[model samples]
Target: MKFATQLIHGGPAVDPEYGSLCHPLYHSSTFAQQSMDHFGRFDYARSGNPTREALEEAIASLEGGSTGLAFASGMAAISSTFLLFSPGDHLVVCEDVYGGTFRALSTLFARWGLTVTFVDATDISAIGAAILPHTKAIYLETPSNPLIKITDLRQAAALAKRHGLLTIVDNTFMTPYLQRPLELGCDIVLHSGTKFLNGHSDVVCGFAVTADPEVGKRLQFIQNAFGAVLGPQDSWLVLRGLKTLKVRMEQSQSAAGQIVQWLESQQCVTKVYYPGLPSHPGFQVHREQASGAGAVLSFELESYILTKRLLEGVKLCAFAVSLGGVESILSYPARMSHASMPAEEREARGIKDTLVRLSVGLEDPADLMADLDRVLNG
Candidate 1:
């Protein structure tokens, strides 16, 4: 089935017991057993739930993976994926990945005895050189957070395959509609359902889809052991969000292009990092892997003070941390998302104090442009 069709109707014909068209929230924490044997696949909510399972199946099918595991948050999904690696195992990761992922690897995971090497993923040689005998996985975030760096998933996946390393990707920005990393040879695909997948900024959730059954089993065990599974209402929200993903992404991407163009034309702006622009270094690599230049883009103002002024001055867009909401949102990565990383480390990754990232929503292009113009020109 096609992506759009599979999104709405892929998991089940309808809720089995209730015969409801929409997935019903199984609010109970425990289910009853008929014969003191297995209780029809779900015995506890922490282990599994019908609503979460339906959402998981939908994501798995949508991303063309063997199965999906839902989590409490994006960090939980990432941490659970990392749990597949043992203490002595090493990992190769993008330097400009999401802030929470970065913290998890550099701080928490490091404390737990796992070794990680951060490299510029766009440079194939850098990635190749960083690989060690202990390297068990490569964690990549294409169109990386704040910096908007694009990693060539096909090339990276080929390298991982040659080295017998697992490839895990954070597919939050592009969503399954634009990019399916697993189909491009990535072993596991992840999403922060709080963002574009939920589409409304009303929920925080995460999911991991895998082609390997062993990986799926390992993840399921960790999910159950750790108990970070998504709640029923959030699962329902994600299910509703998936239904309109194609339409919402199209609108968001269109508005983002207009915003990027406007940012490039402004005198106060120094540089714009967006895949849609010809000037973007990773434009070709991005186009080779994904369908559209996603809705998030970052630009640098001439001064840090000016950057602060613009963020505060923008009336229409919310000054916020998270992205992928239906309403326009703006963020200062230096302070908000990437704040956990030390200043020197963030600077090394090219996330400067003058940089501001925008998640373009479904707002009218003219209104967004006007609001931005007031900040850039006023």
Candidate 2:
């Protein structure tokens, strides 16, 4: 079936109990059982809920995974997955990974004795060199965080399999609509549903998807034990937002392409980092692995003065903390996204002080470009 059709009909068609088109929300904390000898499928809301189950099944179908586990937030999902490894185990991660993940690894994971080696994952050889005998997994973010560097998912996942290590890819930026890592041989795909999947920005939720039943069982156990499962209301919100994902992604990507072209002509903008552009180093590789370039892009200004002006002067695209909504967002990476990293570490990873990231919205391309021009060149 086509991806667009899958978005609407991939999971449950309607409310099975009521025959209603929309899935019914079960708001009760606990389900009553007439007999203690045999209990219902879902005894507690944390363990399971009808509303949450529907959303989970939808995400699993969209990502081509056998199971999907939801969490309170993106970080909670990531942290719980990391806990799957024992204390002595090691992991090799991308150098420019999201700041929140980096903070968790450097602080909490470090204290727990789970070591991680940071590498330039764009170079597969670098990943190989960093792996240790105890390395249990390879974790990465393609079109990585603020720098927007691309990692070859196919090659990386293959490398992990050869080493008997699990491969985990964060699919928040691309979403399942643009990229399905499990289909590309990845063991796990993670998403911050708060961003694109919950396109309205009204919900904060996360998902961990896998095709392997054993891994799914383990994740389900951790989700229940950790007790960070997403609420039924937020789960319904993400499920509803996911229905229009295809259209929203297409419109946002089209506007991003136009904005990339306009940014190249401006003297104040030093460089544009977007996989869709022909000049991008990963353009060909990205095309081979993913269906689209996605809507998020990062750029650098020639100087701090110009960067500050563009971020502060923009009226249309709000200078904000997060990305992937109907409204455009202009974020300062040095402060907003990658601020958890130390200044020196951020500099080494090429997240300079003048760099800013943009998450294009469904706004008209001409209007978005004009707003940028007024700020950068006025």
Candidate 3:
């Protein structure tokens, strides 16, 4: 089936028992067994639920993966996945990963003895050079957080294969609809469902999916043991949100392209980072792998004064931290998404004080541009 069809019909579409169009929400914490000798598939809510299961199946089918695990939040999914490895093991991660992921690794995981090496993943050679004897995985965030840097996923996956390391891609920016990293040879795909997957900004959830059954089993074990599973209601919300993934992405991406063009023409703008732009360094490589440039872009202002004005003056676009919603969101990387990173380190990684990230939404292009203009030029 095509992607759009799969979004609505890929998983268990109807309530099997009642024949309802929407899946039924099984809210019980425990289930009764017909006999002690034989038990049902779901014994406890922590292990699974019918509502969450349907959402998980949908995500697995959408990403073309064998298994899908859902969690309470994006960090829960990532932290649970990290539990797959031992304490002495090391990991090579993209330099500009999400701030929450970096904090978890640098503080929590580091204390637990899981070392990490951060490198610019755009250079496949840097990934190879960073590998050590104990390195177990390569964690990446293409069209990376706030900055919009694109990494060559296929090449990086191949390089990881040679070194016998797991290739994990955070598919948050480019959802499964735009870029299926598993299809590009990545071992696992991760997502912050709160963003594009839910799209409504009402639910906080995450997912971890893998095409390899053995890896799936390992993650499933960790998910069950950690007890960070998504609730049935949130799962149902995400399932409803999945139905409109294709349409929402199409509209948002179209608006982003128009906004990027306008930002490039503005006098206050210094540099714009978007994979859709031909002048962007990774434009060709991104085009080779993904279907679209996604709905997010970043730009640098002439000065911090202009940046602050734009952030505070915007009337239509929301001045917020999170993105990928129906309403446009404007964020400051230095203070919002990447604020956890130290000042010197953030600058070294190219997240500047004047840099602003915008997640274009389903807003009309003309209105958005006018709102931006009043704030930027007024």
Candidate 4:
């Protein structure tokens, strides 16, 4: 089926209990067994929920993966994926990753004996040099969080395959519509469904899809064991949001292109980091794999005070954390999202206090541009 068609009708034919066209919420925490032997695919809410299952099935199909797991939040999903490895295992991660993921690995996972090596994932040679004999996997975010660095998925997959390592990609930025990592040979794909997949800020959710059935099964075990599965209501809301993902993304991307060009022309802006810009270092590499430049873009202001002014001055864009909402949202990585990382660490990766990331929304580009111009020029 076409991507758009699949987004709306990828899972079950109808709601199991109500026979409704839409997937119904299964709110019960536990299920009853007909006999001493458990029957019918569900035992408890943590293990399974019909609504959550339906959403997972949809994501799995959409991502071309064997199975899918949904989580309470994106970090929970990422942490669960990392759980596949044990103590003493090494992981090579992109330097400019999402702040929460950085905190999870450097602070939490490091304490558990997981050694992490940061590298410029965009440079394949750097990634190769960083990999240790104990390296179990490579975790990366393409068109990376604040800097917009693009990693070559196929190249990384080939390298991982040669060394018997796993390749896990955070596909939250592009969503399944723009890129399907499984087809690129990535072992697993992760998403902050709170972003593009959910397309609205109301739901905080995460999802993982694996091309390998065995890997999928192992992830399922971890999900059930860890019990961070997303609730039924959130799952249903995600399903609803996903229905309009194609349209929402199309409009948002269109606006982002315009915004990036405008930002580049502004005197208050030092540099604009967007894969859509032809001058961007990651532009060609990103175009080689993904279909379009995603909506999220980051830029550096002339100064921290200017950054604060631009953020506070914007009337239309939301001055908030997180991305991929119907309303445009702005975030300061240094203070809001990646504040946990130390100043030196963040600087080494190209994320600065003056960096401002924008999640372009569905609003008219003209209005959005006018508001931004007023803020910057005023």
Considering only N, C-alpha and C atoms within 3 Å, which residue pairs clash in candidate 1? none
lDDT tens digits by residue: candidate 4, 189-217: 99999998998899999999999999999
What TM-score quantifies how close candidate 1 is to the native fold?
Answer: 0.98
Q: TM-score per candidate, in order? A: 0.98, 0.98, 0.99, 0.98
Query: Mind sharing the TM-score for model 2?
Result: 0.98
lDDT of 2 by residue, 284-363 (tens): 88899899999999999999998999999998898998899999999998998888999999999999999999999988
Candidate 1 vs candidate 2, lDDT winner: 2
* Global CA lDDT computed for model 3: 0.93
Task: Report how far residue 293 has shifted in candidate 3, in Å.
Answer: 0.6
Q: Give lDDT per model, in order.
A: 0.91, 0.92, 0.93, 0.92
Candidate 3 wrongly placed segments (more than 4 Å): none
What's the best-to-worst order under lDDT? Answer: 3, 4, 2, 1
- lDDT at position 290, candidate 1: 93
Best by lDDT: 3
Worst 10 residues of 2 by lDDT: 9-18
